[model samples]
Target: MKRMFTLLALVWAGSSMGADWQVTQSDSISAYVLCHQGDCPVRTAKVFDLPVAVPMPARVSDSAAKPVTMHSSTSVRFALASARLSQTEKAKLKAFLKRHRDARRFLVVGSTDQIGKKRFNETLAYKRGMAVAVFMRANGIPNRNIKVDSRCCIEHPPSTNPDARRAVISINE
Candidate 1:
């Protein structure tokens, strides 16, 4: 019995590269003998010292963990050659903005009809786009989130008779 216990302790310590051992063998009054050198009768340590390895979990990036954003657009038409917002147009734009309160960006694009001088039409389109930008600012949208693109005498959505005067507002969340 004594030889068996000693042999087992030697094998366990050798396999583990000098690891501590604790003998749980039976005796007349059973007890344990814990030591560093694996010697039951001559103990040099009372505490067990052993190395254990645990694997870490994989990591995820911000783009991978986050949901993809999709863009949505709304078109608000202006009266011929006018940069002013009518009451009904304002109401419709307000409702659209309310539905997109969490939007990350607001791209306001103003387009003009082809019946005017190139420079005059460009300025008018800019004013129309700025009008939409100002309305967005008043409705709690920040200045940094708003961008204006003024297009004059040019067809944004190509058409055969492209004289449409409108502001297209696109939001991306």
Candidate 2:
């Protein structure tokens, strides 16, 4: 008989609290008061001291906005004070051009060591660049797509290394 009275008291206490209140769990917590019957005052009641979660907008990728650019270079050595291409160097240039035939643009840059006069080195570099450009054009590269440039001892200076004076064929896409 005593247990029955305790059970009845617990049931009464639960019934006094509104059944319309619901708790939902997500990334954050939310409480909602829903009224199945019309015009329940609990539906409009303000909830205090509970955090509400605001949903964030979805993110978008921007990979398409930037284009992919690829670059490659091959060094072709030339004789001192001359812009002539050796047979081995010509073969190397041919192979390099064939490998990068599909590139969008080609930049043939020539550089010389700081041994000769500055003006002469500049002319030498330009000739070397032109020679590589001509070869590329003959092979298959479009005339408009190829750009010839000469650094002319500005970057690489005279050293024991013969490779300091050379034509650099660069392909870019």
Candidate 3:
């Protein structure tokens, strides 16, 4: 019977020889050893080295006031001497307004081609800006947030060759 018990112990040791062991550690400084077989006795366990802690990066404050401006990719075009918005222009402006719903302020600046008289063009520009501002107000943007400006033909046109008659919407935050 003693011989049979010794043989059983030898078999168990042989089976454990091919098994694998793993150790896992976390920030809590506690570790666990996993053995493929039944709980193996832990002997002379030591941590050779520990990982160093890294400092976290600082985050930017949300309260910092920064001005952000965005312009429409395509100008809102109008027929000569008219402030009426075309169907396409209306759709484009609607899409723009929807995208910038979070904007706190907007500057609608209008311009005209150099073909018309300076004073007439200036009046036309102002009217066009007012039209856009009115549209924005109708779409739930507050009047206080809307600022109208008319450039007439003073500033360089966005497009050099084409007629400069268009409304430009600038969103500010």
Candidate 4:
């Protein structure tokens, strides 16, 4: 029994000395014995020390992992030429914004009909954009999160037809 116990002990020690391990990305940061060298035990190593550790390193297969996607806020489209917001539209939009205020960043774009001249359209668009942004700001939205852009006559051509100047509000999460 004593001989048997001694034999088992020797076998255990030998097997532990030859423990099979791979210097994976995790192991590269630590030290462990590798199976490649029959009798060599690797000591503590920095990631730079191992030459084989980085050769054609394992590629992260996008397909193998679950696709990571970020959620985006739905875009709100409103008619700019209209003078006023209908009651239902205002209520619904206000409620939605109230719920999403924490994560929303807004962009208000104002456009004008190509009625007078290019310069006139540009001025109108700028004012409309500013108006929309100010309106939103008045409605509990912060000024910091809002961006205003104008597309005057560039977007609207009076030659095409008579159209009202417009403003649009967009939100991003």
Best by lDDT: 1
Write one digit per residue (lDDT tens) for candidate 1, span 72-138. Answer: 8887878877999999889999999888889989899998878678898899999999999999999
- The per-prediction CA RMSD against the true structure, in angstroms, equals 19.6, 15.8, 15.1, 17.3
- Whole-structure CA lDDT of model 3: 0.77
Better of 1 and 4 by TM-score: 1
Going through the candidates in the order shown, the clash numbers are 0, 0, 0, 1
TM-scores, one per candidate: 0.58, 0.58, 0.55, 0.43
Tens-digit lDDT string for candidate 4 (41-143)? 5557656664565568677867678644434332222344433445554565577667666655777676776556778668777777776666667788888
lDDT of 2 by residue, 79-115 (tens): 8888888899989999997787789788888878877
CA lDDT, candidate 4, residue 69: 42
Candidate 1 lDDT score relative to the true structure: 0.81
By TM-score, how accurate is candidate 3?
0.55
- Enumerate residue pairs that collide in model 2: none
